[model samples]
Target: MYAATRIKNRQRVCRTLVAALLMSAGAGAASAQDQPTISMAINQSPWLDSFVAMVDQYEEETGNRVELDVTPFGGLLEKIRNSVRASQGSYDIVNVNSLWLSEIYSGGFLAPLGEIEANYQLPEGVLSYGNTTNWDASAATFSSDGALMGVPVNGNVQVLYYNTEIYEQFGLKPPKTWDDLFANAKAIQEGGEYYGFVPRAARDSIVYNFTPYLFSHDAAFFRITGPDQAEVTLNSPEGLKALETYVKIATEAGPPGPGNIAQGELIQLMATGKGAQAIAVIAAWGQLEDPNASRVVGKINAALLPAGPDGMIASSAGHWVAGIPKNVAPEKQKAALAFLDWFAQKERQVDYVRAGGVPVRGDITGADLGDEAAFRFIEAYSQNARHAVMGLPFASAAEASDAMALSFNRAVIGELTQVQALNQAAADLAGVLERAGFTVSKLPDL
Candidate 1:
């Protein structure tokens, strides 16, 4: 009954919204075309609760109409793609994940913010993802010379999360390397108290979860050779070693059916006190301390992800970005610009974190939210963001990542040996890059 009433209320709200828009078109000195009425497309994510409330506040404060279209993470890409292709302005603003940045921007479907605001500059304290949002067509890579296409919506990067109580019980220190992690996780799992690890090995996101391991082991999916050129390098000795450790830890210390684990499941494992540790995005920190959402609140502590073979941490930058769609009409573009203009305000950065969204500006990352515990992970988050690597940033990033993800999932599921998966993935990635017009070659398979 409540669900039905809520749906009806939503319908009524939509009707009222449309009516208000019509009335404003005739009443305001600013033309209806110049009004900041827009539909923003975003994925339903862990941070949606805070973001929605913030959007409501924006509407209430400015009296501008905004239609937020939420979609599942998987379908968001296609929705943005189809909307851009239609060229009818179904959405004025679109969410762009770091992985999708190259693909969407390189295709010329999104307009640069500079084109909308000639005097534009990213707000102070905005965290940098050097050139990831800026695409250089001539070089076929993110470069300083590229068009500045998007702004950081949230700063998210993988961080090592662990149960401090579990570590205390085990008399263990934090894991700093792959071998250290493996040994510690094995010990915890054998203690029979809780899972020692829970990686996000789901096929849809395995590449993201696996990136730190690959980089730490000194392996890469593709090595940039020159402008518009790369070589598939995943089948190298380092990658083989990385995969071996990844599979070994997931199977020996992680919950069964490891290949099916994603962010939600990983969070549940830790939140319910069933798991001891995992490397997960810092955005998860928001819900970890809420009494209703977590039983182990305040028991969780974060650190840098385990260092690689080279003794360097290599967490992947997974920040979501916001940009305008080029296919939209000029009026819609201006409407989108107004929203971004509001977004660029520094005061809103603090409000964003308090409302559960991660802020991109480093200066305000540690802003007080009345609850000291709310941003306890800010130190680790900021450190990780500073060193985060851009994962598979290129026009064919999706295709390449998909191919790699499939092989990684199969390996985790025991459907294929790690080496077989790596070789298959490398070959598949090579083909993907070659077809995308990148001059691709292959490193000798291990």
Candidate 2:
């Protein structure tokens, strides 16, 4: 009975989504000569080729043209900001990072998907695979006040990648906790063939690499105390401990010039066997199996990140989503939504995964991928995404992240002690919130 009920429910969702799609098509149907060209801004990454292929398929099937402007992940947000400020319909569809969604939505630059289709509902599986609480609180990321805003294209989470040969050589088991990770890193470093671990520590990348440690140790930038009151909380003992652990790893066991490392470099370091382990985005794992890019193709293995003192595996969700800008013509808006609807279908999503993109739908993650190691890693990542948090969801998230990055990079370079760094970060964050019109109380001393 339970199985039957589930099947019926899934069929119902499919029917509803299909109905919405048909409605969208009918609403926008016009003379063939009146169709407008659509363009999209996408991030250049491992998945770019796959997305391009999908877009080609879209064009072939719909007789519509889409120009793709591929930009580096670091620059995409700034590009969107500039375009929105000018009210230029530079692109009909825009790729958005989860952390940047609140800013874009609050800026009034997005056309609420709800307004486009009032009865449209996300597939049950998509919601099941995301951080449900966050999806509710910051609905703008996926939907705003029950209106869909974007379709998630990539589901990202941090995982630990280790060199199996190195672990066995040193008699080390996969780390179950942060202490184990540190000890293993130190041992691997002392053993001399490779650095113990390599993690992204560049100014822009440090916050992402540090979040797991911070959350595992029960530290956060702010804690809501009342209906509208909050306090900075990153100067507590847990915060200091997490920062100290990060600094020790970077200075003692990481590669020379730790501050210069970013995700691409870190991946190469691991793939070239220069590093024994890396804690990075799971999406990069696909590259590790590429013969053209990796030397240690079969030598690498992945696992859920080590837990913290609280015995919880804390990961950050860095999923990428696609939204339509409000500046586009109404016809272009409809075309963009039509494209998004087709791209997010289950069959296309599966094709995307097979072609090197990360799948954000639960059914896709749970599907049998035939490769045991690949399936195991993706399964772990999917589980992590459900509980992960994208910290600092306010419009000032970028500013807050920058402040934390400065403090973290300072600690990495030995300019400040862990306590000093975190305290300074807390103060910086408080100032950011205050300027944004939120009342923040002073954090208690550790």
Best by lDDT: 1
Per-residue lDDT of candidate 1, residues 297-394 (tens digit): 98999987888778877888899888898888877887777666555455665666666677776665454444467577877777777667776878
After superposition, which runs of candidate 2 have C-alpha atoms over 4 Å from their true positions? 1-37, 61-65, 72-75, 85-88, 127-147, 224-229, 365-367, 372-376
In candidate 2, what are the lDDT values of residues 325-424, reduced to their tens digit? 8888888887777777767766656556665667777666544455545455666666666657666766688899998898889889888778778888
Against the true structure, whose TM-score is highest? 1
Off-target runs (Cα >4 Å) in candidate 1 are 1-35, 60-63, 329-332, 413-416
Taken over the whole model, the C-alpha lDDT of each candidate is 0.77, 0.73
The residue-level lDDT of candidate 2 at 228 comes to 42
